[model samples]
Target: MTGLIMNERDIVVPGEKIASGMDYLPGNGTFREGEDIYSSQLGLVGVNGRFVKVIPLTGKYTPREGDIVVGKVVDVGFGMWNVDIGSAYSAILNMRETSEFIDRGADLSHYYDFNDVVIAQVTKVVRYKDVNLTMKGQGLRKVKGGKIIDVTPSKVPRIIGKQGSMIKMIKEGTGCNIVVGQNGKVWIKGERIEDEVKATEVILKIEQESHTQGLTDTIKNILEGKGK
Candidate 1:
């Protein structure tokens, strides 16, 4: 019989034996040497169907279609801006995609210049390895007077939680505007700097302890204590 040695979110190391025997086999992040599967990196175990994979707890961003991302303008063209999305591939924001009625003759920098941080949605994934982004939608625009934090891209969904329950709690507790990017970037802004700091701390804490159960309740207690 095949046996699984780790649970989801369990931290594992390179060359660790994940499973053994021939009735079941491992996939991605594992190499099969005869009847046993060995891990490739130090990461958390993720089981998908019969395949066991490892999600690197620490790594750079990887782009995907329809992922909401936080990015900074790096280069401004006549009708588009080049943004760094923390990926090996750079993203492009076309003039038409930035706004509904962008005048062809208007200066693109007026809308977004170099070093401007903005929240955008990935619209398309190019086959040649480039991503197209758009900013024309609700809650998508330039971010001002806030700090950005970087987290592991794979942990983003956990930080956000199912149906955004985690983020909703953080916003309600701290009264801060928090935007989570699928690319592992976060933007936080609040009326007061102290609130912003609290929000950031809460988010980082979630990122670090996402694997644990009862995270929502733990976070609520932390926020409640802040009121005292």
Candidate 2:
């Protein structure tokens, strides 16, 4: 019965019907018809037992409250910084949220300059989609001593894997500390230069083959080969 339909991780297009009957339920990126499930966007199919879902292959990150994101400072102004988070609108990080003491006349560049990468959390998102970011939290600050990279925002989950098992493997294997932002910015830091490069390769590979099955083992082998 299962083999009659599209396999897991198969790329699907919009309005393409993939499954039928009451045995399967539609999940993300899919919608239910009379007795069939159809893909609502370009994505990869996911069949975990009886639950059917679609993993989006391409999309931008939409801001949401409490979303931790890595952003680049693109512009600086009066008491605020504009961040590019790969979205239509740039997120705003105000100095008030950055420190307890902020003088109105003080130069903001002393804290964050143009092109500085920052890991921040979306404290508030207005109806107009203006994202307010804050760094006053544990492990949220300017990125230093690490390599920053970008990936498709939609692929972040696959990079994270089930219960964060995938990323954990990459970290343990490469001996790198990794921070993943839901906005698709990743910061990797390793004790050794070679380890950081290895970790970066693993991350990019995972992003490329995120829909493939058995990816965990595949990534492990790549990391091991680099270690040797």
Candidate 3:
């Protein structure tokens, strides 16, 4: 038989027992030993029927294939660009994936230079955690005239909310264009500088208080000018 020993949303530590029995299966941030399940990281417990998982509260961002992320150009090289995507390793964006072709002796810096920000996707992850990035898909491009911010990767889902409802609220409320990256980077742009600042504050708030209940309501109140 299997049973959950911890309540959903409760914080758990590594090696702490979360469930027991073969009937239960471990999900992310959890592992199984015999009929027992234990936490593999510090995170909140989540139980769905026979499946139990943990949502991490703090950790470095891990790159995943097909994940869209915001990145900063760290260096422009001969035929490749190095991007800082908030990971343990920098990601590589090659000229072939960036465009069809360019002159052999062209200045790559003209295309992407140091300190420029962009929205990209992870196309491959090789051994030793080397990441490859691409920006050819829809809505992926260089980000100009916007402020970029950071948030914990684990809190990104909550910042997005159910079907992007939360982010939609912030955009509609402040008239800001926001792009959230899976690597914990956010880019915000608005007509008024104040709107952009407010939106950033709101996102940071959500990042900090994602585990708290009624967070949507709180954010709604903040956006409506009804709360601080």
- Return the TM-score for each candidate structure: 0.85, 0.78, 0.87
True-structure lDDT of candidate 1: 0.86
TM match of model 3 to true structure:
0.87
Tens digit per residue, CA lDDT, model 2, 1-228: 333277787889999888888888888788888888889989889998877888877887877899899989999999899999887799999988894577888988888999998999999988727889998999888877788888999888889989999999999998898999999989999999888898888999999887678998898888787677
Off by over 4 Å in 3: 1-3, 21-26, 32-35, 48-51, 226-228
lDDT of 3 by residue, 63-155 (tens): 889999999999998889999999888999988777446788889899888999989999999862889998789988988888999999988
Comparing 2 and 3 by lDDT, which wins?
3
TM-score, structure 1 vs. true: 0.85
Error of 2 at 19 (Å): 10
lDDT for each residue of candidate 1 in 111-228, tens digit (9 for 90 to 100):
8988999999999887727889999788889988789999889889988888999899899999998999999999999989999999989988988898789998999999999946
lDDT of 2 at 108: 88
User: Model 1: number of clashes?
Assistant: 0
Against the reference, the lDDT scores of all candidates come to 0.86, 0.87, 0.90
Candidate 2's clash total is 0
| Residue 197, candidate 3: C-alpha displacement in angstroms | 1.3
Order of the predicted models by TM-score, top scorer first: 3, 1, 2
